[model samples]
Target: MDLALKKQILQKAQDWFVESIAQNHIKNTEKLIKPTEFKINPFTAVYLANFLTGNSNPESIAKALVYPRVLGTSITTSFGTNIQKFTSEVLSAFGSTTSGIDIEFIDQLDGFKKYCQMKSGPETINKDDVETIAKHFSGVLNLAKTNSLRIAHSDMIVGVLYGDSGDLNAHYKRITSEYHFPVYDLSPELVPFS
Candidate 1:
Protein backbone atom coordinates (compact mmCIF):
# COMPACT_ATOMS: atom_id res chain seq x y z
CA MET A 1 0.00 0.00 0.00
CA ASP A 2 1.14 3.54 -0.77
CA LEU A 3 1.45 6.13 1.96
CA ALA A 4 -1.47 8.25 0.77
CA LEU A 5 -3.95 5.37 0.55
CA LYS A 6 -2.78 4.01 3.86
CA LYS A 7 -3.43 7.39 5.45
CA GLN A 8 -6.88 7.52 3.87
CA ILE A 9 -7.79 4.09 5.18
CA LEU A 10 -6.55 4.92 8.65
CA GLN A 11 -8.50 8.19 8.70
CA LYS A 12 -11.66 6.42 7.59
CA ALA A 13 -11.15 3.78 10.24
CA GLN A 14 -10.83 6.44 12.93
CA ASP A 15 -13.99 8.13 11.69
CA TRP A 16 -15.87 4.87 11.88
CA PHE A 17 -14.59 4.22 15.40
CA VAL A 18 -15.91 7.62 16.46
CA GLU A 19 -19.30 6.94 14.87
CA SER A 20 -19.54 3.62 16.71
CA ILE A 21 -18.95 5.38 20.02
CA ALA A 22 -21.85 7.69 19.20
CA GLN A 23 -24.18 4.72 18.89
CA ASN A 24 -23.55 3.64 22.47
CA HIS A 25 -23.47 7.10 24.04
CA ILE A 26 -25.83 7.91 26.87
CA LYS A 27 -28.10 10.00 24.68
CA ASN A 28 -28.14 7.22 22.08
CA THR A 29 -28.65 4.27 24.40
CA GLU A 30 -31.96 3.59 22.69
CA LYS A 31 -30.05 2.51 19.61
CA LEU A 32 -28.35 -0.15 21.68
CA ILE A 33 -31.60 -1.47 23.17
CA LYS A 34 -33.40 -1.69 19.86
CA PRO A 35 -34.45 -5.21 18.85
CA THR A 36 -31.95 -6.94 16.60
CA GLU A 37 -32.89 -8.60 13.37
CA PHE A 38 -32.79 -12.09 14.87
CA LYS A 39 -33.11 -11.44 18.59
CA ILE A 40 -36.29 -10.09 20.17
CA ASN A 41 -36.29 -8.00 23.32
CA PRO A 42 -37.52 -8.86 26.82
CA PHE A 43 -35.35 -11.92 27.33
CA THR A 44 -36.97 -13.93 30.11
CA ALA A 45 -33.65 -15.63 30.81
CA VAL A 46 -32.07 -12.38 31.97
CA TYR A 47 -35.11 -11.62 34.08
CA LEU A 48 -35.01 -15.07 35.62
CA ALA A 49 -31.31 -14.72 36.43
CA ASN A 50 -31.96 -11.37 38.06
CA PHE A 51 -34.79 -12.87 40.09
CA LEU A 52 -32.59 -15.73 41.28
CA THR A 53 -29.90 -13.28 42.32
CA GLY A 54 -32.40 -11.40 44.50
CA ASN A 55 -31.59 -8.06 42.82
CA SER A 56 -35.21 -7.33 42.11
CA ASN A 57 -34.84 -3.56 42.56
CA PRO A 58 -36.32 -1.61 39.63
CA GLU A 59 -32.92 -0.18 38.64
CA SER A 60 -31.33 -3.64 38.81
CA ILE A 61 -34.14 -5.10 36.70
CA ALA A 62 -33.68 -2.40 34.05
CA LYS A 63 -29.94 -2.91 34.02
CA ALA A 64 -30.32 -6.65 33.60
CA LEU A 65 -32.71 -6.17 30.71
CA VAL A 66 -30.38 -3.81 28.88
CA TYR A 67 -26.99 -5.27 29.71
CA PRO A 68 -26.68 -7.46 26.63
CA ARG A 69 -27.42 -4.52 24.35
CA VAL A 70 -24.31 -2.66 25.48
CA LEU A 71 -21.96 -5.58 24.81
CA GLY A 72 -20.48 -4.02 21.59
CA THR A 73 -22.24 -6.06 18.93
CA SER A 74 -22.90 -2.92 16.89
CA ILE A 75 -19.28 -1.90 17.06
CA THR A 76 -18.14 -5.27 15.79
CA THR A 77 -20.62 -5.25 12.92
CA SER A 78 -19.76 -1.69 11.94
CA PHE A 79 -16.06 -2.40 11.95
CA GLY A 80 -16.46 -5.37 9.64
CA THR A 81 -18.51 -3.43 7.09
CA ASN A 82 -16.44 -0.24 7.19
CA ILE A 83 -13.12 -2.04 6.93
CA GLN A 84 -14.19 -3.82 3.77
CA LYS A 85 -15.49 -0.59 2.28
CA PHE A 86 -12.24 1.28 2.86
CA THR A 87 -10.15 -1.56 1.47
CA SER A 88 -12.29 -1.77 -1.61
CA GLU A 89 -12.02 1.96 -2.07
CA VAL A 90 -8.25 1.97 -1.80
CA LEU A 91 -7.77 -1.08 -4.03
CA SER A 92 -10.02 0.48 -6.61
CA ALA A 93 -7.15 2.82 -7.30
CA PHE A 94 -5.26 -0.14 -8.76
CA GLY A 95 -7.89 -2.14 -10.66
CA SER A 96 -11.59 -2.31 -11.21
CA THR A 97 -14.15 -4.84 -9.99
CA THR A 98 -15.02 -5.68 -13.61
CA SER A 99 -14.24 -9.38 -13.12
CA GLY A 100 -17.30 -9.93 -10.88
CA ILE A 101 -15.21 -10.25 -7.73
CA ASP A 102 -15.32 -7.90 -4.81
CA ILE A 103 -12.22 -5.97 -5.95
CA GLU A 104 -9.08 -6.34 -8.02
CA PHE A 105 -5.81 -4.58 -7.41
CA ILE A 106 -2.47 -4.53 -9.15
CA ASP A 107 0.23 -5.92 -6.93
CA GLN A 108 2.85 -3.24 -6.51
CA LEU A 109 5.78 -5.65 -6.37
CA ASP A 110 4.71 -8.29 -8.90
CA GLY A 111 2.75 -5.89 -11.20
CA PHE A 112 0.02 -8.49 -11.59
CA LYS A 113 -3.68 -7.97 -11.05
CA LYS A 114 -5.07 -9.73 -8.00
CA TYR A 115 -8.74 -10.56 -7.59
CA CYS A 116 -9.78 -10.37 -3.99
CA GLN A 117 -12.65 -10.99 -1.61
CA MET A 118 -12.07 -8.86 1.44
CA LYS A 119 -12.86 -10.43 4.79
CA SER A 120 -12.99 -8.63 8.12
CA GLY A 121 -11.00 -11.15 10.12
CA PRO A 122 -9.94 -14.76 10.24
CA GLU A 123 -12.75 -15.71 12.64
CA THR A 124 -15.46 -14.10 10.52
CA ILE A 125 -16.20 -17.22 8.49
CA ASN A 126 -17.39 -20.76 9.14
CA LYS A 127 -17.28 -24.22 7.51
CA ASP A 128 -20.02 -23.53 5.00
CA ASP A 129 -18.59 -20.12 4.21
CA VAL A 130 -15.32 -21.69 3.16
CA GLU A 131 -17.00 -23.82 0.49
CA THR A 132 -19.04 -20.86 -0.69
CA ILE A 133 -15.87 -18.80 -1.11
CA ALA A 134 -14.24 -21.55 -3.13
CA LYS A 135 -17.26 -21.76 -5.38
CA HIS A 136 -17.18 -18.00 -5.97
CA PHE A 137 -13.53 -18.06 -6.90
CA SER A 138 -14.04 -21.01 -9.20
CA GLY A 139 -16.95 -19.30 -10.87
CA VAL A 140 -14.79 -16.27 -11.61
CA LEU A 141 -12.03 -18.47 -12.92
CA ASN A 142 -14.42 -20.17 -15.27
CA LEU A 143 -15.73 -16.84 -16.45
CA ALA A 144 -12.23 -15.61 -17.12
CA LYS A 145 -11.43 -18.68 -19.22
CA THR A 146 -14.57 -18.24 -21.34
CA ASN A 147 -13.70 -14.64 -22.10
CA SER A 148 -10.00 -15.27 -22.69
CA LEU A 149 -9.21 -13.14 -19.65
CA ARG A 150 -5.60 -13.71 -18.65
CA ILE A 151 -6.21 -14.67 -15.04
CA ALA A 152 -4.97 -17.47 -12.83
CA HIS A 153 -6.42 -19.24 -9.85
CA SER A 154 -3.41 -18.05 -7.93
CA ASP A 155 -4.61 -14.52 -8.44
CA MET A 156 -7.62 -15.12 -6.27
CA ILE A 157 -7.05 -14.04 -2.69
CA VAL A 158 -8.96 -13.89 0.58
CA GLY A 159 -7.79 -10.59 2.06
CA VAL A 160 -8.18 -10.54 5.81
CA LEU A 161 -8.13 -7.08 7.37
CA TYR A 162 -7.09 -8.20 10.86
CA GLY A 163 -5.05 -11.02 12.46
CA ASP A 164 -1.60 -12.12 11.38
CA SER A 165 -0.87 -15.45 9.69
CA GLY A 166 0.48 -16.90 12.96
CA ASP A 167 -2.77 -16.31 14.82
CA LEU A 168 -5.09 -16.97 11.85
CA ASN A 169 -8.23 -19.00 12.51
CA ALA A 170 -8.80 -22.48 11.14
CA HIS A 171 -11.15 -21.30 8.43
CA TYR A 172 -8.51 -19.00 6.88
CA LYS A 173 -5.88 -21.73 7.05
CA ARG A 174 -8.30 -24.14 5.40
CA ILE A 175 -8.85 -21.68 2.55
CA THR A 176 -5.16 -21.85 1.69
CA SER A 177 -4.28 -25.38 2.80
CA GLU A 178 -7.33 -27.40 1.79
CA TYR A 179 -9.12 -25.21 -0.75
CA HIS A 180 -6.03 -24.06 -2.68
CA PHE A 181 -6.79 -20.39 -2.07
CA PRO A 182 -4.29 -17.89 -0.72
CA VAL A 183 -5.01 -15.90 2.44
CA TYR A 184 -3.33 -12.49 2.64
CA ASP A 185 -3.38 -10.37 5.76
CA LEU A 186 -3.54 -6.59 5.36
CA SER A 187 -0.73 -5.53 7.62
CA PRO A 188 2.84 -4.40 7.65
CA GLU A 189 5.40 -6.83 6.20
CA LEU A 190 7.04 -7.33 9.58
CA VAL A 191 4.54 -9.97 10.68
CA PRO A 192 5.70 -13.56 10.98
CA PHE A 193 4.39 -16.22 8.62
CA SER A 194 5.39 -19.67 7.45
Candidate 2:
Protein backbone atom coordinates (compact mmCIF):
# COMPACT_ATOMS: atom_id res chain seq x y z
CA MET A 1 0.00 0.00 0.00
CA ASP A 2 1.01 3.62 -0.55
CA LEU A 3 2.33 5.54 2.47
CA ALA A 4 -0.66 7.91 2.66
CA LEU A 5 -3.20 5.12 2.42
CA LYS A 6 -1.36 3.03 4.98
CA LYS A 7 -1.23 5.94 7.42
CA GLN A 8 -4.92 6.61 6.92
CA ILE A 9 -5.79 3.00 7.64
CA LEU A 10 -3.73 2.98 10.83
CA GLN A 11 -5.28 6.20 12.10
CA LYS A 12 -8.80 5.08 11.32
CA ALA A 13 -8.19 1.73 13.00
CA GLN A 14 -6.90 3.40 16.17
CA ASP A 15 -9.85 5.78 16.24
CA TRP A 16 -12.17 2.85 15.86
CA PHE A 17 -10.42 1.07 18.71
CA VAL A 18 -10.98 4.00 21.07
CA GLU A 19 -14.61 4.42 20.05
CA SER A 20 -15.29 0.74 20.53
CA ILE A 21 -13.90 0.80 24.09
CA ALA A 22 -15.96 3.82 25.08
CA GLN A 23 -19.23 2.45 23.71
CA ASN A 24 -18.96 -1.16 24.77
CA HIS A 25 -22.05 -2.48 26.52
CA ILE A 26 -23.16 -5.97 27.42
CA LYS A 27 -26.83 -6.79 27.14
CA ASN A 28 -26.66 -9.55 29.72
CA THR A 29 -24.56 -8.67 32.74
CA GLU A 30 -25.99 -11.62 34.60
CA LYS A 31 -24.17 -14.08 32.41
CA LEU A 32 -20.80 -15.12 33.78
CA ILE A 33 -17.77 -14.69 31.54
CA LYS A 34 -14.35 -16.02 32.39
CA PRO A 35 -11.24 -14.22 31.19
CA THR A 36 -9.09 -16.10 28.74
CA GLU A 37 -5.33 -16.26 28.38
CA PHE A 38 -5.56 -14.61 25.00
CA LYS A 39 -5.20 -10.84 24.87
CA ILE A 40 -7.00 -10.18 21.61
CA ASN A 41 -8.24 -6.65 22.21
CA PRO A 42 -8.14 -4.36 19.16
CA PHE A 43 -6.36 -1.72 21.18
CA THR A 44 -3.60 -4.18 21.86
CA ALA A 45 -3.41 -5.00 18.19
CA VAL A 46 -3.27 -1.29 17.33
CA TYR A 47 -0.59 -0.68 19.92
CA LEU A 48 1.48 -3.47 18.49
CA ALA A 49 1.10 -2.05 15.02
CA ASN A 50 1.97 1.44 16.16
CA PHE A 51 5.07 0.16 17.92
CA LEU A 52 6.22 -1.72 14.86
CA THR A 53 5.61 1.26 12.57
CA GLY A 54 7.16 3.77 15.01
CA ASN A 55 3.91 5.76 15.14
CA SER A 56 3.40 5.72 18.89
CA ASN A 57 1.32 8.47 20.45
CA PRO A 58 0.41 9.25 24.04
CA GLU A 59 -3.30 9.17 23.23
CA SER A 60 -3.06 5.50 22.33
CA ILE A 61 -1.70 4.59 25.76
CA ALA A 62 -4.03 6.97 27.64
CA LYS A 63 -6.99 5.23 26.04
CA ALA A 64 -5.65 1.86 27.16
CA LEU A 65 -7.08 2.40 30.68
CA VAL A 66 -10.58 2.30 29.16
CA TYR A 67 -9.97 -0.96 27.35
CA PRO A 68 -12.96 -2.93 28.57
CA ARG A 69 -12.17 -6.20 30.28
CA VAL A 70 -15.11 -6.18 32.65
CA LEU A 71 -16.73 -9.03 30.77
CA GLY A 72 -13.31 -10.55 30.30
CA THR A 73 -12.97 -12.93 27.35
CA SER A 74 -16.41 -12.24 25.94
CA ILE A 75 -15.78 -8.51 25.74
CA THR A 76 -12.30 -8.91 24.31
CA THR A 77 -13.46 -11.36 21.64
CA SER A 78 -16.41 -9.15 20.70
CA PHE A 79 -14.17 -6.10 20.40
CA GLY A 80 -11.67 -8.01 18.27
CA THR A 81 -14.44 -9.21 15.98
CA ASN A 82 -15.87 -5.71 15.61
CA ILE A 83 -12.49 -4.13 14.84
CA GLN A 84 -11.55 -6.81 12.33
CA LYS A 85 -14.82 -6.42 10.46
CA PHE A 86 -14.59 -2.64 10.62
CA THR A 87 -11.03 -2.65 9.32
CA SER A 88 -11.87 -5.05 6.53
CA GLU A 89 -14.84 -2.94 5.44
CA VAL A 90 -12.70 0.18 5.41
CA LEU A 91 -9.95 -1.57 3.47
CA SER A 92 -12.41 -2.91 0.92
CA ALA A 93 -13.51 0.66 0.10
CA PHE A 94 -10.04 1.33 -1.30
CA GLY A 95 -10.82 -0.89 -4.28
CA SER A 96 -14.24 -2.52 -4.43
CA THR A 97 -17.80 -1.48 -3.67
CA THR A 98 -18.49 -3.82 -0.74
CA SER A 99 -22.17 -4.56 -0.22
CA GLY A 100 -24.86 -7.10 0.38
CA ILE A 101 -27.11 -8.61 -2.31
CA ASP A 102 -29.08 -5.45 -3.01
CA ILE A 103 -27.47 -4.27 -6.28
CA GLU A 104 -24.66 -4.95 -8.71
CA PHE A 105 -22.56 -2.70 -10.93
CA ILE A 106 -22.67 -4.86 -14.01
CA ASP A 107 -20.58 -2.73 -16.35
CA GLN A 108 -17.76 -2.08 -13.90
CA LEU A 109 -14.13 -2.78 -14.71
CA ASP A 110 -14.30 -6.21 -13.16
CA GLY A 111 -17.45 -6.88 -15.22
CA PHE A 112 -19.41 -7.88 -12.09
CA LYS A 113 -19.66 -6.70 -8.51
CA LYS A 114 -18.17 -9.00 -5.90
CA TYR A 115 -19.64 -10.25 -2.64
CA CYS A 116 -16.92 -10.87 -0.07
CA GLN A 117 -16.92 -12.79 3.18
CA MET A 118 -13.99 -11.71 5.30
CA LYS A 119 -12.36 -13.65 8.10
CA SER A 120 -9.96 -12.26 10.70
CA GLY A 121 -7.52 -15.13 10.64
CA PRO A 122 -6.79 -18.71 9.65
CA GLU A 123 -8.94 -20.04 12.47
CA THR A 124 -10.35 -23.50 12.05
CA ILE A 125 -13.75 -23.86 10.41
CA ASN A 126 -16.06 -26.74 10.99
CA LYS A 127 -18.34 -28.60 8.59
CA ASP A 128 -21.40 -26.80 9.95
CA ASP A 129 -19.67 -23.48 9.38
CA VAL A 130 -19.04 -24.37 5.77
CA GLU A 131 -22.63 -25.47 5.33
CA THR A 132 -23.91 -22.26 6.88
CA ILE A 133 -21.73 -20.22 4.55
CA ALA A 134 -23.04 -22.15 1.56
CA LYS A 135 -26.59 -21.51 2.70
CA HIS A 136 -25.86 -17.79 3.08
CA PHE A 137 -24.52 -17.61 -0.49
CA SER A 138 -27.54 -19.53 -1.75
CA GLY A 139 -29.81 -17.06 0.01
CA VAL A 140 -27.97 -14.13 -1.54
CA LEU A 141 -28.21 -15.69 -4.98
CA ASN A 142 -31.94 -16.12 -4.55
CA LEU A 143 -32.25 -12.58 -3.30
CA ALA A 144 -30.31 -11.24 -6.28
CA LYS A 145 -32.56 -13.07 -8.75
CA THR A 146 -35.68 -11.85 -6.98
CA ASN A 147 -34.46 -8.27 -7.13
CA SER A 148 -33.24 -8.56 -10.74
CA LEU A 149 -29.68 -7.68 -9.75
CA ARG A 150 -26.91 -8.41 -12.24
CA ILE A 151 -24.22 -10.68 -10.84
CA ALA A 152 -22.07 -13.61 -11.81
CA HIS A 153 -21.37 -16.85 -10.00
CA SER A 154 -17.66 -16.17 -10.36
CA ASP A 155 -17.77 -12.83 -8.54
CA MET A 156 -17.93 -14.30 -5.07
CA ILE A 157 -14.69 -14.55 -3.06
CA VAL A 158 -13.52 -15.37 0.47
CA GLY A 159 -11.04 -12.90 1.87
CA VAL A 160 -8.76 -13.77 4.78
CA LEU A 161 -6.92 -11.03 6.61
CA TYR A 162 -5.02 -10.42 9.91
CA GLY A 163 -4.36 -13.84 11.35
CA ASP A 164 -1.93 -15.37 13.81
CA SER A 165 1.46 -14.97 12.10
CA GLY A 166 2.95 -18.42 12.53
CA ASP A 167 -0.02 -20.11 10.89
CA LEU A 168 -1.71 -17.28 9.05
CA ASN A 169 -0.22 -17.86 5.62
CA ALA A 170 -0.66 -21.57 5.99
CA HIS A 171 -4.26 -21.05 7.05
CA TYR A 172 -4.93 -18.82 4.06
CA LYS A 173 -3.56 -21.44 1.68
CA ARG A 174 -5.47 -24.21 3.43
CA ILE A 175 -8.73 -22.30 3.27
CA THR A 176 -8.25 -21.42 -0.38
CA SER A 177 -7.52 -25.05 -1.25
CA GLU A 178 -10.35 -26.40 0.88
CA TYR A 179 -13.02 -24.29 -0.81
CA HIS A 180 -13.80 -23.53 -4.42
CA PHE A 181 -14.15 -19.78 -3.92
CA PRO A 182 -11.12 -17.62 -4.69
CA VAL A 183 -9.38 -16.33 -1.56
CA TYR A 184 -7.24 -13.25 -1.16
CA ASP A 185 -4.80 -12.89 1.72
CA LEU A 186 -4.79 -9.16 2.38
CA SER A 187 -2.96 -9.12 5.68
CA PRO A 188 -0.78 -6.07 6.21
CA GLU A 189 2.85 -6.36 5.14
CA LEU A 190 4.31 -5.88 8.59
CA VAL A 191 1.82 -8.12 10.32
CA PRO A 192 0.45 -11.03 8.37
CA PHE A 193 -2.02 -12.02 11.05
CA SER A 194 -1.50 -9.97 14.15
Candidate 3:
Protein backbone atom coordinates (compact mmCIF):
# COMPACT_ATOMS: atom_id res chain seq x y z
CA MET A 1 0.00 0.00 0.00
CA ASP A 2 1.08 3.52 -0.60
CA LEU A 3 1.91 5.62 2.42
CA ALA A 4 -0.96 8.00 1.71
CA LEU A 5 -3.63 5.31 1.45
CA LYS A 6 -2.41 3.54 4.59
CA LYS A 7 -2.59 6.76 6.53
CA GLN A 8 -6.06 7.45 5.18
CA ILE A 9 -7.36 4.01 6.14
CA LEU A 10 -5.90 4.26 9.63
CA GLN A 11 -7.39 7.67 10.13
CA LYS A 12 -10.80 6.49 8.92
CA ALA A 13 -10.73 3.47 11.23
CA GLN A 14 -9.75 5.57 14.22
CA ASP A 15 -12.41 8.11 13.45
CA TRP A 16 -15.06 5.44 13.15
CA PHE A 17 -14.08 3.88 16.48
CA VAL A 18 -14.12 7.22 18.24
CA GLU A 19 -17.50 8.14 16.82
CA SER A 20 -18.96 4.75 17.64
CA ILE A 21 -17.86 5.04 21.26
CA ALA A 22 -19.35 8.47 21.56
CA GLN A 23 -22.64 7.34 20.09
CA ASN A 24 -22.82 4.33 22.38
CA HIS A 25 -22.17 6.55 25.39
CA ILE A 26 -24.92 8.93 24.48
CA LYS A 27 -27.36 6.14 23.78
CA ASN A 28 -26.59 4.47 27.11
CA THR A 29 -27.04 7.67 29.17
CA GLU A 30 -30.51 6.50 30.12
CA LYS A 31 -29.00 3.39 31.75
CA LEU A 32 -30.98 1.03 29.59
CA ILE A 33 -29.81 -2.53 30.10
CA LYS A 34 -31.06 -3.58 26.70
CA PRO A 35 -29.18 -1.58 24.12
CA THR A 36 -30.47 -3.36 21.04
CA GLU A 37 -33.78 -1.55 21.23
CA PHE A 38 -32.09 1.68 20.28
CA LYS A 39 -30.93 2.10 16.74
CA ILE A 40 -27.35 3.04 15.95
CA ASN A 41 -26.67 6.64 15.09
CA PRO A 42 -26.78 7.61 11.42
CA PHE A 43 -23.05 8.26 11.22
CA THR A 44 -22.28 4.68 12.13
CA ALA A 45 -24.69 3.46 9.52
CA VAL A 46 -22.91 5.55 6.91
CA TYR A 47 -19.52 4.37 8.11
CA LEU A 48 -20.46 0.71 7.80
CA ALA A 49 -22.12 1.26 4.47
CA ASN A 50 -19.07 3.05 3.13
CA PHE A 51 -16.83 0.32 4.45
CA LEU A 52 -18.89 -2.23 2.56
CA THR A 53 -19.49 -0.44 -0.71
CA GLY A 54 -16.63 2.08 -0.77
CA ASN A 55 -19.18 4.78 -1.47
CA SER A 56 -20.28 7.59 0.80
CA ASN A 57 -23.19 8.84 -1.26
CA PRO A 58 -26.54 9.46 0.42
CA GLU A 59 -28.25 6.72 -1.57
CA SER A 60 -25.70 4.21 -0.40
CA ILE A 61 -26.07 5.38 3.18
CA ALA A 62 -29.84 5.11 2.97
CA LYS A 63 -29.56 1.64 1.49
CA ALA A 64 -27.16 0.68 4.26
CA LEU A 65 -29.55 1.97 6.88
CA VAL A 66 -32.06 -0.61 5.71
CA TYR A 67 -30.07 -3.23 7.61
CA PRO A 68 -30.33 -2.04 11.16
CA ARG A 69 -29.24 -5.39 12.54
CA VAL A 70 -25.79 -5.04 11.03
CA LEU A 71 -25.52 -1.53 12.36
CA GLY A 72 -26.44 -2.70 15.85
CA THR A 73 -23.51 -5.08 16.06
CA SER A 74 -20.48 -3.46 17.66
CA ILE A 75 -17.08 -3.64 16.11
CA THR A 76 -14.77 -6.23 17.63
CA THR A 77 -12.12 -4.90 20.01
CA SER A 78 -9.27 -6.14 17.84
CA PHE A 79 -11.11 -5.46 14.58
CA GLY A 80 -10.27 -9.01 13.50
CA THR A 81 -13.85 -9.99 12.82
CA ASN A 82 -14.47 -6.74 10.98
CA ILE A 83 -11.44 -7.31 8.78
CA GLN A 84 -12.56 -10.85 8.06
CA LYS A 85 -15.96 -9.58 6.99
CA PHE A 86 -14.32 -6.94 4.83
CA THR A 87 -12.20 -9.58 3.15
CA SER A 88 -15.23 -11.72 2.63
CA GLU A 89 -17.03 -8.80 1.03
CA VAL A 90 -14.09 -8.22 -1.24
CA LEU A 91 -14.19 -11.84 -2.29
CA SER A 92 -17.89 -11.54 -2.93
CA ALA A 93 -17.15 -8.75 -5.37
CA PHE A 94 -15.49 -11.48 -7.41
CA GLY A 95 -18.61 -13.68 -7.08
CA SER A 96 -17.56 -15.79 -4.09
CA THR A 97 -19.29 -16.13 -0.72
CA THR A 98 -18.27 -19.46 0.80
CA SER A 99 -16.49 -18.36 3.99
CA GLY A 100 -16.68 -21.63 5.95
CA ILE A 101 -12.94 -21.94 5.32
CA ASP A 102 -12.25 -18.20 5.19
CA ILE A 103 -12.79 -18.10 1.41
CA GLU A 104 -13.66 -20.60 -1.29
CA PHE A 105 -14.26 -19.59 -4.90
CA ILE A 106 -14.82 -21.38 -8.15
CA ASP A 107 -13.44 -20.04 -11.39
CA GLN A 108 -16.30 -19.89 -13.85
CA LEU A 109 -14.18 -20.09 -16.97
CA ASP A 110 -12.02 -23.10 -16.20
CA GLY A 111 -13.96 -24.90 -13.45
CA PHE A 112 -11.04 -24.29 -11.11
CA LYS A 113 -11.46 -23.85 -7.39
CA LYS A 114 -9.52 -21.95 -4.75
CA TYR A 115 -9.58 -22.41 -1.02
CA CYS A 116 -8.27 -19.67 1.24
CA GLN A 117 -7.59 -19.11 4.92
CA MET A 118 -7.56 -15.47 5.97
CA LYS A 119 -5.93 -13.66 8.88
CA SER A 120 -5.74 -10.00 9.78
CA GLY A 121 -2.01 -10.20 10.24
CA PRO A 122 0.80 -12.34 11.55
CA GLU A 123 0.90 -13.64 15.09
CA THR A 124 3.08 -16.01 17.05
CA ILE A 125 2.08 -19.65 16.64
CA ASN A 126 3.42 -22.78 18.27
CA LYS A 127 4.07 -26.14 16.65
CA ASP A 128 0.84 -27.58 17.97
CA ASP A 129 -1.29 -24.90 16.38
CA VAL A 130 0.43 -25.40 13.07
CA GLU A 131 -0.14 -29.13 13.17
CA THR A 132 -3.77 -28.62 14.12
CA ILE A 133 -4.35 -26.25 11.22
CA ALA A 134 -2.75 -28.67 8.80
CA LYS A 135 -4.77 -31.57 10.12
CA HIS A 136 -7.99 -29.58 9.91
CA PHE A 137 -7.40 -28.68 6.29
CA SER A 138 -6.44 -32.24 5.50
CA GLY A 139 -9.76 -33.44 6.86
CA VAL A 140 -11.67 -30.88 4.80
CA LEU A 141 -9.86 -31.83 1.63
CA ASN A 142 -10.32 -35.53 2.28
CA LEU A 143 -14.02 -35.08 2.84
CA ALA A 144 -14.37 -33.12 -0.37
CA LYS A 145 -12.59 -35.82 -2.31
CA THR A 146 -14.67 -38.56 -0.74
CA ASN A 147 -17.85 -36.76 -1.71
CA SER A 148 -16.73 -36.70 -5.35
CA LEU A 149 -16.43 -32.94 -5.30
CA ARG A 150 -14.60 -31.20 -8.08
CA ILE A 151 -11.08 -30.89 -6.72
CA ALA A 152 -9.55 -29.96 -10.06
CA HIS A 153 -7.18 -27.04 -10.21
CA SER A 154 -7.75 -26.39 -6.57
CA ASP A 155 -5.14 -24.30 -4.80
CA MET A 156 -4.76 -23.74 -1.10
CA ILE A 157 -4.18 -20.05 -0.58
CA VAL A 158 -3.32 -18.06 2.53
CA GLY A 159 -4.19 -14.38 2.62
CA VAL A 160 -2.76 -11.92 5.11
CA LEU A 161 -4.90 -8.80 5.27
CA TYR A 162 -2.76 -6.38 7.25
CA GLY A 163 0.36 -5.84 9.33
CA ASP A 164 1.45 -3.68 12.22
CA SER A 165 4.86 -3.70 13.94
CA GLY A 166 5.00 -7.44 13.36
CA ASP A 167 6.63 -8.74 10.20
CA LEU A 168 3.48 -10.24 8.73
CA ASN A 169 5.08 -10.47 5.28
CA ALA A 170 7.86 -12.63 6.68
CA HIS A 171 5.36 -14.76 8.54
CA TYR A 172 3.37 -15.28 5.36
CA LYS A 173 6.54 -16.29 3.56
CA ARG A 174 7.39 -18.84 6.23
CA ILE A 175 3.86 -20.24 6.27
CA THR A 176 3.73 -20.56 2.48
CA SER A 177 7.07 -22.28 2.35
CA GLU A 178 6.34 -24.62 5.24
CA TYR A 179 2.89 -25.63 4.06
CA HIS A 180 3.64 -25.53 0.33
CA PHE A 181 0.75 -23.12 -0.19
CA PRO A 182 0.60 -19.86 -2.08
CA VAL A 183 0.43 -16.61 -0.13
CA TYR A 184 -1.45 -13.54 -1.28
CA ASP A 185 -0.47 -10.26 0.36
CA LEU A 186 -3.74 -8.28 0.28
CA SER A 187 -2.53 -5.38 2.40
CA PRO A 188 -1.96 -3.20 -0.62
CA GLU A 189 -5.48 -2.68 -1.91
CA LEU A 190 -7.64 -4.38 0.71
CA VAL A 191 -8.37 -1.70 3.31
CA PRO A 192 -10.86 -3.10 5.75
CA PHE A 193 -11.16 0.09 7.70
CA SER A 194 -12.09 2.31 4.78
Q: Largest TM-score belongs to which candidate?
A: 1
Judged by whole-model lDDT over C-alpha atoms, candidate 3 comes out at 0.53
**Model 1 lDDT tens row, 1-194:** 57977787677656755665454444445555444522534566456447756666656655555564454565566556566556644334333454435667776666778787777776788888789888888988888899999888778888777787777778878888887888887553212224
lDDT of 2 at 70: 43
User: What lDDT tens digits, residue by residue, belong to model 2 across residues 80-185?
Assistant: 5674446444454333343432112232345556565656555644556555555555666677789998655555555555545465444344434554545544
Q: Where does model 3 exceed 4 Å of error? A: 1-76, 91-100, 106-111, 124-127, 152-154, 163-166, 169-171, 187-194
Tens digits of per-residue lDDT for model 3 on 1-194? 46986687666656654555445544544343343655757778779779868987876765565444333433223355555555444334132344335666553345576666666565633456455555556666777789998553235555566554345445455554576555555553433221
Instruction: Estimate candidate 1's RMSD in Å.
Output: 4.3
List lDDT for all candidates, in order: 0.66, 0.50, 0.53
RMSD list, candidates in order: 4.3, 11.8, 14.2
- Which of 1 and 3 is the better model by TM-score? 1
Give lDDT: candidate 1, residue 153. Answer: 78
Best candidate (score: lDDT): 1
Backbone clash count, each prediction separately? 0, 1, 0
